[model samples]
Target: MNMQVWASLFGVVLGGLLSYLAQFTTVRVAGRNEERRQAAQRAEARRAERLELLREFVTIAQEGIRVAEERDQAPDWAAAGTPEWFAAGRSVIDRLWVAERMIQILFPPRLYRLARTYASAVDHVLWRLPDQIAAEGSMWHHLRDPQHEFLEAARTELGAHP
Candidate 1:
Protein backbone atom coordinates (compact mmCIF):
# COMPACT_ATOMS: atom_id res chain seq x y z
CA MET A 1 0.00 0.00 0.00
CA ASN A 2 0.99 3.66 -0.39
CA MET A 3 2.37 5.53 2.68
CA GLN A 4 -0.66 7.88 3.02
CA VAL A 5 -3.13 4.97 2.80
CA TRP A 6 -1.28 3.06 5.54
CA ALA A 7 -1.31 6.10 7.86
CA SER A 8 -5.07 6.63 7.26
CA LEU A 9 -5.84 3.03 8.21
CA PHE A 10 -3.81 3.36 11.45
CA GLY A 11 -5.75 6.52 12.40
CA VAL A 12 -9.13 4.85 11.94
CA VAL A 13 -8.14 1.88 14.17
CA LEU A 14 -6.92 4.19 16.96
CA GLY A 15 -10.14 6.25 16.81
CA GLY A 16 -12.26 3.09 17.03
CA LEU A 17 -10.34 1.84 20.09
CA LEU A 18 -10.71 5.21 21.85
CA SER A 19 -14.46 5.29 21.18
CA TYR A 20 -14.89 1.76 22.61
CA LEU A 21 -12.99 2.67 25.76
CA ALA A 22 -15.06 5.83 26.33
CA GLN A 23 -18.31 3.90 26.04
CA PHE A 24 -17.08 1.21 28.45
CA THR A 25 -16.03 3.84 30.97
CA THR A 26 -19.45 5.48 30.81
CA VAL A 27 -21.18 2.17 31.39
CA ARG A 28 -18.99 1.40 34.41
CA VAL A 29 -19.63 4.79 35.97
CA ALA A 30 -23.35 4.45 35.48
CA GLY A 31 -23.33 1.03 37.13
CA ARG A 32 -21.57 2.37 40.22
CA ASN A 33 -24.07 5.22 40.55
CA GLU A 34 -26.95 2.79 40.30
CA GLU A 35 -25.45 0.60 42.99
CA ARG A 36 -25.20 3.56 45.32
CA ARG A 37 -28.79 4.50 44.61
CA GLN A 38 -29.92 0.99 45.48
CA ALA A 39 -27.88 1.00 48.66
CA ALA A 40 -29.55 4.23 49.77
CA GLN A 41 -32.94 2.73 49.08
CA ARG A 42 -32.15 -0.37 51.13
CA ALA A 43 -31.00 1.78 54.01
CA GLU A 44 -34.25 3.69 53.86
CA ALA A 45 -36.28 0.52 54.03
CA ARG A 46 -34.31 -0.69 57.02
CA ARG A 47 -34.83 2.63 58.76
CA ALA A 48 -38.56 2.48 58.18
CA GLU A 49 -38.72 -0.97 59.65
CA ARG A 50 -36.70 0.12 62.66
CA LEU A 51 -38.96 3.10 63.26
CA GLU A 52 -42.01 0.87 63.11
CA LEU A 53 -40.50 -1.34 65.76
CA LEU A 54 -39.84 1.68 67.94
CA ARG A 55 -43.46 2.72 67.53
CA GLU A 56 -44.51 -0.62 68.94
CA PHE A 57 -42.50 0.10 72.06
CA VAL A 58 -44.08 3.53 72.34
CA THR A 59 -47.50 1.95 72.10
CA ILE A 60 -46.63 -0.53 74.78
CA ALA A 61 -45.26 2.23 76.96
CA GLN A 62 -48.58 4.02 76.68
CA GLU A 63 -50.48 0.89 77.63
CA GLY A 64 -48.05 0.15 80.38
CA ILE A 65 -48.67 3.61 81.82
CA ARG A 66 -52.37 2.91 81.86
CA VAL A 67 -51.73 -0.43 83.48
CA ALA A 68 -49.68 1.27 86.13
CA GLU A 69 -52.41 3.80 86.85
CA GLU A 70 -55.33 1.45 87.47
CA ARG A 71 -57.19 2.40 90.64
CA ASP A 72 -58.47 -1.10 91.34
CA GLN A 73 -55.03 -2.72 91.39
CA ALA A 74 -51.38 -1.82 91.79
CA PRO A 75 -48.96 -1.74 88.86
CA ASP A 76 -47.86 -5.12 87.59
CA TRP A 77 -44.24 -4.98 88.62
CA ALA A 78 -44.16 -8.75 88.91
CA ALA A 79 -45.00 -9.09 85.23
CA ALA A 80 -42.61 -6.28 84.36
CA GLY A 81 -39.68 -8.26 85.69
CA THR A 82 -40.98 -11.50 84.33
CA PRO A 83 -39.84 -13.08 81.08
CA GLU A 84 -42.94 -11.69 79.41
CA TRP A 85 -42.29 -7.94 79.53
CA PHE A 86 -38.66 -8.55 78.95
CA ALA A 87 -39.52 -10.52 75.84
CA ALA A 88 -41.79 -7.77 74.55
CA GLY A 89 -39.25 -5.06 75.30
CA ARG A 90 -36.52 -7.21 73.85
CA SER A 91 -38.51 -7.57 70.65
CA VAL A 92 -38.43 -3.82 70.10
CA ILE A 93 -34.91 -3.26 71.38
CA ASP A 94 -33.48 -6.15 69.39
CA ARG A 95 -34.89 -4.85 66.13
CA LEU A 96 -33.27 -1.49 66.76
CA TRP A 97 -30.01 -3.22 67.53
CA VAL A 98 -30.19 -5.19 64.29
CA ALA A 99 -31.03 -2.12 62.24
CA GLU A 100 -28.09 -0.20 63.66
CA ARG A 101 -25.86 -3.17 63.10
CA MET A 102 -26.93 -3.34 59.50
CA ILE A 103 -26.04 0.32 58.95
CA GLN A 104 -22.33 0.31 59.69
CA ILE A 105 -21.82 -2.70 61.98
CA LEU A 106 -19.16 -0.75 63.89
CA PHE A 107 -18.80 2.81 62.66
CA PRO A 108 -21.43 4.49 64.88
CA PRO A 109 -21.68 3.28 68.46
CA ARG A 110 -24.39 5.71 69.51
CA LEU A 111 -27.34 3.42 68.85
CA TYR A 112 -25.88 0.55 70.81
CA ARG A 113 -25.00 2.75 73.73
CA LEU A 114 -28.41 4.35 73.66
CA ALA A 115 -30.21 1.05 73.64
CA ARG A 116 -28.09 -0.16 76.51
CA THR A 117 -28.77 2.98 78.46
CA TYR A 118 -32.53 2.64 78.13
CA ALA A 119 -32.47 -1.06 78.76
CA SER A 120 -30.66 -0.39 82.01
CA ALA A 121 -33.08 2.39 82.87
CA VAL A 122 -36.04 0.14 82.31
CA ASP A 123 -34.39 -2.48 84.46
CA HIS A 124 -33.89 0.06 87.22
CA VAL A 125 -37.47 1.29 86.93
CA LEU A 126 -38.72 -2.25 86.96
CA TRP A 127 -36.99 -2.95 90.25
CA ARG A 128 -38.17 0.24 91.98
CA LEU A 129 -41.82 -0.64 91.28
CA PRO A 130 -44.92 1.36 92.49
CA ASP A 131 -42.44 3.43 94.50
CA GLN A 132 -40.89 4.51 91.24
CA ILE A 133 -44.38 5.13 89.94
CA ALA A 134 -44.09 8.51 91.62
CA ALA A 135 -40.71 8.77 89.92
CA GLU A 136 -41.98 7.27 86.68
CA GLY A 137 -42.06 10.77 85.31
CA SER A 138 -38.43 11.17 86.23
CA MET A 139 -37.47 7.81 84.75
CA TRP A 140 -39.25 8.71 81.54
CA HIS A 141 -37.41 12.02 81.54
CA HIS A 142 -34.08 10.24 81.63
CA LEU A 143 -35.33 7.91 78.89
CA ARG A 144 -36.16 10.83 76.63
CA ASP A 145 -32.69 12.32 76.84
CA PRO A 146 -30.97 9.17 75.63
CA GLN A 147 -33.44 8.73 72.83
CA HIS A 148 -32.93 12.31 71.67
CA GLU A 149 -29.16 12.06 71.77
CA PHE A 150 -29.19 8.80 69.82
CA LEU A 151 -31.41 10.21 67.14
CA GLU A 152 -29.29 13.31 66.78
CA ALA A 153 -26.18 11.18 66.51
CA ALA A 154 -27.85 8.96 63.94
CA ARG A 155 -28.85 11.95 61.87
CA THR A 156 -25.31 13.22 61.95
CA GLU A 157 -23.88 9.82 61.10
CA LEU A 158 -26.38 8.97 58.38
CA GLY A 159 -26.55 12.50 56.99
CA ALA A 160 -30.30 12.27 57.40
CA HIS A 161 -32.65 13.95 59.85
CA PRO A 162 -35.07 11.84 61.89
Candidate 2:
Protein backbone atom coordinates (compact mmCIF):
# COMPACT_ATOMS: atom_id res chain seq x y z
CA MET A 1 0.00 0.00 0.00
CA ASN A 2 1.02 3.66 -0.48
CA MET A 3 2.43 5.54 2.51
CA GLN A 4 -0.42 8.09 2.46
CA VAL A 5 -3.04 5.30 2.47
CA TRP A 6 -1.24 3.53 5.36
CA ALA A 7 -1.08 6.76 7.34
CA SER A 8 -4.80 7.40 6.74
CA LEU A 9 -5.67 3.90 7.96
CA PHE A 10 -3.58 4.44 11.12
CA GLY A 11 -5.31 7.74 11.83
CA VAL A 12 -8.77 6.15 11.49
CA VAL A 13 -7.93 3.31 13.92
CA LEU A 14 -6.44 5.71 16.47
CA GLY A 15 -9.50 7.96 16.32
CA GLY A 16 -11.86 5.00 16.82
CA LEU A 17 -9.79 3.70 19.77
CA LEU A 18 -9.79 7.11 21.45
CA SER A 19 -13.54 7.54 20.94
CA TYR A 20 -14.25 4.11 22.46
CA LEU A 21 -12.02 4.79 25.43
CA ALA A 22 -13.68 8.13 26.12
CA GLN A 23 -17.18 6.62 25.93
CA PHE A 24 -16.21 3.73 28.20
CA THR A 25 -14.74 6.06 30.79
CA THR A 26 -17.78 8.34 30.72
CA VAL A 27 -20.20 5.45 31.15
CA ARG A 28 -18.22 3.96 34.03
CA VAL A 29 -18.05 7.27 35.87
CA ALA A 30 -21.73 7.95 35.32
CA GLY A 31 -22.66 4.53 36.63
CA ARG A 32 -20.60 5.08 39.77
CA ASN A 33 -22.16 8.50 40.36
CA GLU A 34 -25.65 7.12 39.92
CA GLU A 35 -24.88 4.36 42.44
CA ARG A 36 -23.71 6.93 44.96
CA ARG A 37 -26.86 9.02 44.52
CA GLN A 38 -29.07 5.98 45.04
CA ALA A 39 -27.19 4.98 48.15
CA ALA A 40 -27.63 8.46 49.61
CA GLN A 41 -31.35 8.41 48.90
CA ARG A 42 -31.72 5.02 50.59
CA ALA A 43 -29.87 6.24 53.66
CA GLU A 44 -32.10 9.31 53.93
CA ALA A 45 -35.20 7.19 53.58
CA ARG A 46 -34.03 4.88 56.36
CA ARG A 47 -33.33 7.84 58.61
CA ALA A 48 -36.78 9.27 58.03
CA GLU A 49 -38.36 5.94 58.79
CA ARG A 50 -36.41 5.61 62.01
CA LEU A 51 -37.45 9.08 63.10
CA GLU A 52 -41.09 8.31 62.44
CA LEU A 53 -40.91 5.12 64.44
CA LEU A 54 -39.31 6.93 67.33
CA ARG A 55 -42.05 9.52 67.33
CA GLU A 56 -44.72 6.88 67.29
CA PHE A 57 -43.11 4.95 70.12
CA VAL A 58 -42.78 8.06 72.21
CA THR A 59 -46.38 8.98 71.66
CA ILE A 60 -47.49 5.53 72.67
CA ALA A 61 -45.51 5.69 75.86
CA GLN A 62 -46.94 9.06 76.74
CA GLU A 63 -50.46 7.91 76.06
CA GLY A 64 -49.94 4.86 78.21
CA ILE A 65 -48.89 7.02 81.13
CA ARG A 66 -51.82 9.35 80.70
CA VAL A 67 -54.35 6.55 80.52
CA ALA A 68 -52.95 4.88 83.60
CA GLU A 69 -53.25 8.09 85.55
CA GLU A 70 -56.77 8.70 84.32
CA ARG A 71 -57.85 5.21 85.22
CA ASP A 72 -56.38 5.53 88.63
CA GLN A 73 -58.25 8.75 89.21
CA ALA A 74 -61.53 7.78 87.60
CA PRO A 75 -64.77 8.10 89.60
CA ASP A 76 -66.49 5.14 91.18
CA TRP A 77 -69.02 5.12 88.34
CA ALA A 78 -66.17 4.60 85.85
CA ALA A 79 -64.73 1.67 87.78
CA ALA A 80 -63.21 -1.38 86.10
CA GLY A 81 -65.48 -3.41 83.76
CA THR A 82 -67.52 -0.29 83.01
CA PRO A 83 -67.76 0.92 79.41
CA GLU A 84 -65.68 3.99 80.18
CA TRP A 85 -62.99 1.96 81.86
CA PHE A 86 -62.87 -0.61 79.08
CA ALA A 87 -62.74 2.10 76.42
CA ALA A 88 -59.81 3.83 78.06
CA GLY A 89 -58.02 0.55 78.48
CA ARG A 90 -58.61 -0.47 74.88
CA SER A 91 -57.30 2.81 73.52
CA VAL A 92 -54.00 2.51 75.37
CA ILE A 93 -53.66 -1.19 74.57
CA ASP A 94 -54.32 -0.62 70.90
CA ARG A 95 -51.71 2.10 70.67
CA LEU A 96 -49.18 -0.12 72.38
CA TRP A 97 -50.05 -2.94 70.02
CA VAL A 98 -49.40 -0.76 67.01
CA ALA A 99 -46.06 0.37 68.41
CA GLU A 100 -45.09 -3.21 69.04
CA ARG A 101 -45.89 -4.19 65.47
CA MET A 102 -43.94 -1.26 64.11
CA ILE A 103 -40.93 -2.07 66.23
CA GLN A 104 -41.09 -5.67 65.07
CA ILE A 105 -41.10 -4.60 61.46
CA LEU A 106 -38.68 -1.66 61.50
CA PHE A 107 -36.12 -2.51 64.17
CA PRO A 108 -33.20 -4.89 64.39
CA PRO A 109 -33.47 -7.83 66.76
CA ARG A 110 -31.85 -6.11 69.70
CA LEU A 111 -34.00 -3.03 69.46
CA TYR A 112 -37.10 -5.06 68.84
CA ARG A 113 -36.49 -7.01 72.01
CA LEU A 114 -36.01 -3.85 74.02
CA ALA A 115 -39.20 -2.31 72.69
CA ARG A 116 -41.03 -5.55 73.21
CA THR A 117 -39.99 -5.67 76.80
CA TYR A 118 -41.33 -2.21 77.38
CA ALA A 119 -44.60 -2.99 75.67
CA SER A 120 -45.01 -6.13 77.70
CA ALA A 121 -44.36 -4.28 80.92
CA VAL A 122 -46.90 -1.64 80.01
CA ASP A 123 -49.40 -4.28 79.09
CA HIS A 124 -48.90 -6.06 82.39
CA VAL A 125 -49.33 -2.85 84.30
CA LEU A 126 -52.51 -1.98 82.48
CA TRP A 127 -53.89 -5.46 82.90
CA ARG A 128 -53.33 -5.40 86.60
CA LEU A 129 -54.33 -1.79 87.17
CA PRO A 130 -57.96 -2.60 87.91
CA ASP A 131 -57.07 -5.08 90.63
CA GLN A 132 -54.45 -2.81 92.04
CA ILE A 133 -56.81 0.12 92.11
CA ALA A 134 -59.54 -2.00 93.70
CA ALA A 135 -57.27 -3.47 96.31
CA GLU A 136 -55.37 -0.29 97.09
CA GLY A 137 -58.18 2.24 96.55
CA SER A 138 -56.59 4.85 94.22
CA MET A 139 -53.10 4.83 95.69
CA TRP A 140 -51.26 2.68 93.13
CA HIS A 141 -48.51 3.86 90.83
CA HIS A 142 -47.49 2.01 87.69
CA LEU A 143 -43.81 1.20 87.21
CA ARG A 144 -42.31 3.04 84.21
CA ASP A 145 -38.68 2.01 84.23
CA PRO A 146 -39.12 -0.21 81.19
CA GLN A 147 -40.46 2.69 79.20
CA HIS A 148 -37.26 4.63 79.86
CA GLU A 149 -35.11 1.68 78.88
CA PHE A 150 -36.98 1.21 75.62
CA LEU A 151 -36.64 4.87 74.76
CA GLU A 152 -32.90 4.71 75.30
CA ALA A 153 -32.60 1.62 73.16
CA ALA A 154 -34.66 3.20 70.42
CA ARG A 155 -32.56 6.35 70.50
CA THR A 156 -29.36 4.36 70.22
CA GLU A 157 -30.75 2.29 67.39
CA LEU A 158 -31.68 5.46 65.54
CA GLY A 159 -28.02 6.60 65.68
CA ALA A 160 -28.36 8.91 68.64
CA HIS A 161 -25.61 8.94 71.27
CA PRO A 162 -28.16 8.45 74.06
- Determine which window of 10 residues in candidate 2 has minimal summed lDDT: 136-145
Please give, for residues 36-99, the per-residue lDDT of candidate 2 as tens digits: 9999999999889878887887777667756666655656524534776678878978988887
lDDT of 1 by residue, 15-67 (tens): 99999999999999999999999999998887776565555444544343333
- Please report the TM-score between candidate 2 and the true structure: 0.82
RMSD to the hidden true structure, all candidates: 5.6, 3.1
Off by over 4 Å in 1: 71-109, 116-162
> Model 2: runs farther than 4 Å from truth?
75-81, 130-142
